[model samples]
Target chain A: MENTTKDYSHIKGWGIDADPKNDPTYPMKRRTNEEHLGYSWERPTLQPQTVEILHSNERPNVTAVFGTSTPPSGLSGMIRRLAFKKTENDYGHWLPLILADRINVVEGIIEDLRSGHVPNIFAEKGYKAEWKYNRGGLLRKAAVAAILSYGVVAYFRAKKKRKHNY
Target chain B: MLAMNYRGPLRVRASQKPMPKIEHPQDAIVRVTRSCICGSDLHLYNGSVPDTRVGMTFGHEFTGIVEEVGSEVTKIKVGDHVLVPFNIACGQCAFCKQELYGNCHESNPQATAVGGIFGYSHTAGGYNGGQAEYARVPYANVGPTIIPEGMDPDDAVLLTDVVPTGYQAAEMGGIQKGDTVVVFGAGPVGIMAAKCSWLFGAGRVIIIDQVDYRLEFARNYAQCEAYNFNEIGDPVLFLKKETDWMGADVCIDAVGAEAAGNAMQTITGRKLLLQAGSATAVHWAINSVKKGGIISIVGVYGPTDNLIPIGNVLNKGLTIRANQASVKRLLPRLIEHVQNGVLNPKGLITHRIPLEEVSDAYRIFSEKLDNCIKPILISPSAGL
Candidate 1:
């Protein structure tokens, strides 16, 4: 998943169609100023997140991430534009802020995803029926069955030889 | 009016800014006492939904004290305790009277389409959210419920969502008295649905989840039995046998997206539609409910055209009601249940953290760390 993140980061704005004319920035097709403002409202990834600092009296303290990825600080938003998206936004580039603020949030959210449809522990429904006998019991039973088979084979061989001789 | 600026996941910080005043006379200013993080809020976290800005407050499930009222406002007064259900429906609108604000006919703008709740997706309606210290509630007289005094916020918190949502879940399933109900997933909605089923007087409530912790938690509130989805081969057959081969009378899919657990995805690798996750709770609803029973699907669906078995839906006589929950309708009674000691809803809270630790809380909840079922975002007032 971390590797995928790196790959996705590389493939950020360019994705499949990277055109230079639309985005003179070379890596991505930069939108004009009017296009930037126009697209900002409709584009969900650009939506604002509200983080609440709980005061003394409020009963509910829910921090709503309206419609965006992890809420980066003003600085990381800068890095996202300059280093990745290459748009000179209002935010200023600060790598420390990016590392401290955004990366951890990204990693944590990815960790929360369920491995399967269900939680672990009861995963092996098939293995539940496998506990008929322990290893020791199975070995002992096998030994007894083998001895009985060998004795029956010896008896048959001797009886056949005796009948032929007679 | 207030404006919003999107930043990133778990990173929404309100701006030191304000917007123009409302032009309408019906609008009221609400000093928000408490706004909460919603499961829907996490949609933004996972990049499923996107927003335009960071300055905008995104919370809708809140308990607020009314600060200012418009001249037209009469049903509510200043200094009143209120809970905002996650929508902005004008009571006079045709859809509001019909209780279908998801498609309201009046006061909704942009091609006469419904905007959204306080802080939600664009399809619902785009308005200023209430996750801040204050919010200007439009059409204030309609959905805001005055929370009675002496009610604990912890108990009342679900009033905005889970309590009524639970009822909605069972009600969506058309749960009749003495009916056997099978709820898939035991999150807040699932647990609350089970409790509501018991309240509505279902014969049995089988809360299904693979989490031992959530299942254990359900034992306290739910009157019905519990089934771990991982323990059974075919959930359909298993639920049927539990119903004496008749299937559950009502199947409520409360595991909105993360259905059953992570196990279903492991076996099917994101394609096993039934156990895929709560994302397809509707599918499970159709599959788990009896042929002639009801399916109350509370789990939200993503953009995916499920090839719904029309033949099966017709053949089974299944009744389905799925969409945004109207929790405001049931808050008064839910508050009574909470206050009267009949509903000890606080037991489901698995973690309590200072709201500053929201990013951490999101990690714990998402990762299922410590089997965290329901974590309450405790502010200073709650004394976490």
Candidate 2:
């Protein structure tokens, strides 16, 4: 949580629901004691963890059943570990984790290249469908990419010419 | 059996797969009849949700005919046309006893929050979805309800998720008579939320989205005010201005993780993978609602945290309620609503494609092509 000293007392009806009775769902929402009437059948046996499972820092244990097909690895795994260190509320926890996923995609492409396999970037990104179905948006994206590429090339060429003049 | 196979992000194909079998004594095998691709399924398809493994079939909202039932399953029998609620709840759980099936502790016990959701992802529970010709429905007695006699199969399929989820979104708002309600996202759920708000006596309902076609569709279907947020400068300011600066009494975030309209949110959350999808809709909801107003969230977000305005929520004394819709809880009333012509669940469908053309269905829906509002898949053996 970000620290803040700002007072919110000026806000109208601030803390109006601070009183338990003032709770909007007061009468309608109540704890039922029926929770004790738990599972009738024997609980299913816990699926054995055959791969690395990432869990929240708040949880003391991993879920009984988790997908093991995509275990975290590479740079993304390290960042995911860092993310899990902080509670789910913090930006520090999420941002680095997201950056890791993007990096992991690059890592996947590089691995594909290393294995002498050419990845179909277009089909993989679903751009073929975009061209067919969402032609306008696809063309707009293509135009932006072209303009950006041209600008980068022009900037580098001009820089080289300036160096020769110097 | 042919099933929609998840081949990572932005990829799904109809492929051959072994027919699903009952894994537990309480389980039943359902040969799906009507299946719909949900907005949340797009999150998994776009790779926004984590642990969506390759080869996983991804359909959660489905109505099917029971093929076989396990020994322990007594309430449901073979050949019964059943509408399976996406939540896989064990009827014996305390939450289920309280009618809070979506939060059943016995289901998806690994997660601290929501219960097991069909086809959501591994994070949801590694259960396969109904997008295939057949599905394994666990805890059969608890979640699968028989399709009411004479109910349209299209309506039955949607009752599995969309209608219930949309109705729950409005129900959570606690909309008093004549409360001004603002709904974010003009997707199928958002449109349904906007329409359902009227049932709670909302005087004015306005829906916001970036897509023009969706806004147009919402205007007609929901019979509510609609606007493109991209055209209207700051959504918070615009909503506040429209609501006489008092802000709407209730605001709903129907657009969850994949919300658009904010550059920072998109780059950090969607592109860079900083936050869990974009919190743009959530941010707008918090800022635009009246102080002490209720904000209902039905939008799907990653299990992980996203950047949200907690301070505003505290200072404004806002009430926030969110969860996966407990479909079983809402189904009875929603079915009545459908029967009475109060809600046209099937009217939302704009495209009907065969299960074999699922990849094209995904592309058409994902890209918002042909003005697609909702798409349903028909099994090759649907009538059979």
Candidate 3:
């Protein structure tokens, strides 16, 4: 005689399977689990996944990848080449004032000192603010800044004069 | 590759369709040999069941030869003659394990209204049915049973659905010895239910229907007293008078949606689609059965709510047991009955049309043309 009694161990009441291992397509079926069967509206048990910070969050507390051996190219490369001097350990790239206007070079240097990043110019030789110090690099930088600021003011002044005359 | 295409309500045409291929590791493609147009398919034909998508094929009761098996399909092999159950059950599911194969979870992606039924509609799991030359049977190992050698294929196809449904109707009634049973709708299921009721010790069996031929067939086939509801007065009151105003011990509703009789019910349930198929048969069953008697419903209804007389049910203390037949659970005993010559499952088939003429078969069955009781579609390509 055949056994008519059903084995209820694999049965999940209210229309769901307790063990779906036997059916290979169970995972792909739309109504395979208890949640799809309307048995329980409870959310799925949370899986333990590594939580990595997203691009929208605050930047991590590490030196920026600007002045490394393989420098990033394009507009960022041009900006990095001009703005911050290269450091011994490439640690001065996160100097918070890296985004400050180039005309505020003196203020940027002072802010770097407060932020505990010694400017490469000073670290290379000695702490000096005079024009002749560090191969006259400071004087050269000041001359370039003055020329750019005056050239911008004169062009705008010429455009204003033409608008009034017309 | 010719298959029945659902155009709309009362509109269907046979068109060439692409041969179905195995879609899952558990699926097996079966070359359909004998497919029957089920009475429930009428519900789909009349646009009663929601999501009866057009371009869908529509025959559920089918027997075939397995053409190919997937990598994971182990039980059924290629070229094996088999009868596929209407319910697509993943055998390992909780419901399948408990022998409640009709409520299988993984087969039907739709709402839990019903498990997978081939070609019924999306409401019963949008699996395309077996009306075509080839059909993909998912969870192949679980549902398809090899047709025993020497057993006729015609009988095997009906076993897939109609016979089990009818037998389950009788079983659900919980008929005690010598209990009087009244069955509504003299359709195939009703006749089988009446016939099977006798096996369960029913002393008197009465089947009611408006059609003269079906009523006559019921009397001759089931050996039960049959009545035309139109020839008599209200069937409910007639049943009451015959039972000494006490009512029958059990009532089985074999007619679901699209039932005739109450004008209000017909207008609201059938025309307006307001309630689940006309509850006229259900109303009669509830009122005509003896208080505290059982009412077994093997009829198919829509997934939405129906206007049921719950107050009458509560007052009468009636037990209503209704479900899609769990075919696998009842197969063993039903097969024995067939083998013993006690049951003629294929005796109900009245019309046999080729699969290409499936559209006309649906019309004949739907319109009750030529007194067609059941129509079986024969596939020319089915390696009989």
Which one wins on lDDT?
2
* DockQ of all models, two decimals each: 0.02, 0.18, 0.01
lDDT string, candidate 2, B93-165, tens digits: 5666667778766556334466788887655666778988899888888899999999999989999989888
- Candidate 1 stretches greater than 4 Å from native: A1-166, B1-6, B9-24, B50-56, B100-103, B106-115, B260-278, B378-384
Q: Over the stretch B1-384, how does candidate 1's per-residue lDDT look in tens digits?
A: 222222454343323336323324555666655555655565544433322223344666667677787676788888887777776656543334445543333332211223246665332334566555556676667768777777766665657776777776776665667888888888877888898887777888888888887788788767557777778866777887777888888888776644434444433323342221234455656777788777777665433223345677788987666656655445566778888887776666667655444455554565456677776654433221
Q: What local lDDT score does residue A20 receive in model 3, on the 0 to 100 scale?
A: 40
Kindly give the stretch of ten consecutive residues in candidate 1 chain B with the minimal lDDT sum.
Answer: B106-115
Number of clashing pairs per prediction, in order:
63, 1, 0
Q: Comparing to the true complex, what docking class would candidate 1 get?
A: incorrect
Per-residue CA lDDT of model 3 for B1-384, tens digit only, reads 877766556656666777877656777899999999988899887877754545568878999899999777889999999999998877665556557788765565434446778887655555678888888887787899999988999999999999999998898888889899999998989999999999999999999988888888889889999998887898889999999999999999999997888899999989987776898888899999999998999888876557878898999998898888888888889889998999998889999888766666776677666677888988778767
Chain A TM-scores, all candidates? 0.21, 0.66, 0.25
lDDT (0 to 1) per candidate: 0.55, 0.81, 0.73
Off by over 4 Å in 3: A1-166
TM-score between candidate 1 and the true structure: 0.62
Compared with the true structure, what per-residue lDDT tens digits does model 2 show for residues A70-149?
Answer: 45677777876676677656666655654665576676667667978666655545565577788888889889999999
Ranking by TM-score: 2, 3, 1
Candidate 1, residue B382: CA error in Å? 8.1
Give the per-residue lDDT of model 1 (tens digit) for A34-97.
3222212221111122431111111121111122212334443443334322211212212322
Backbone clashes in model 3: 0
- For model 2, report DockQ: 0.18
TM-score of 3: 0.71
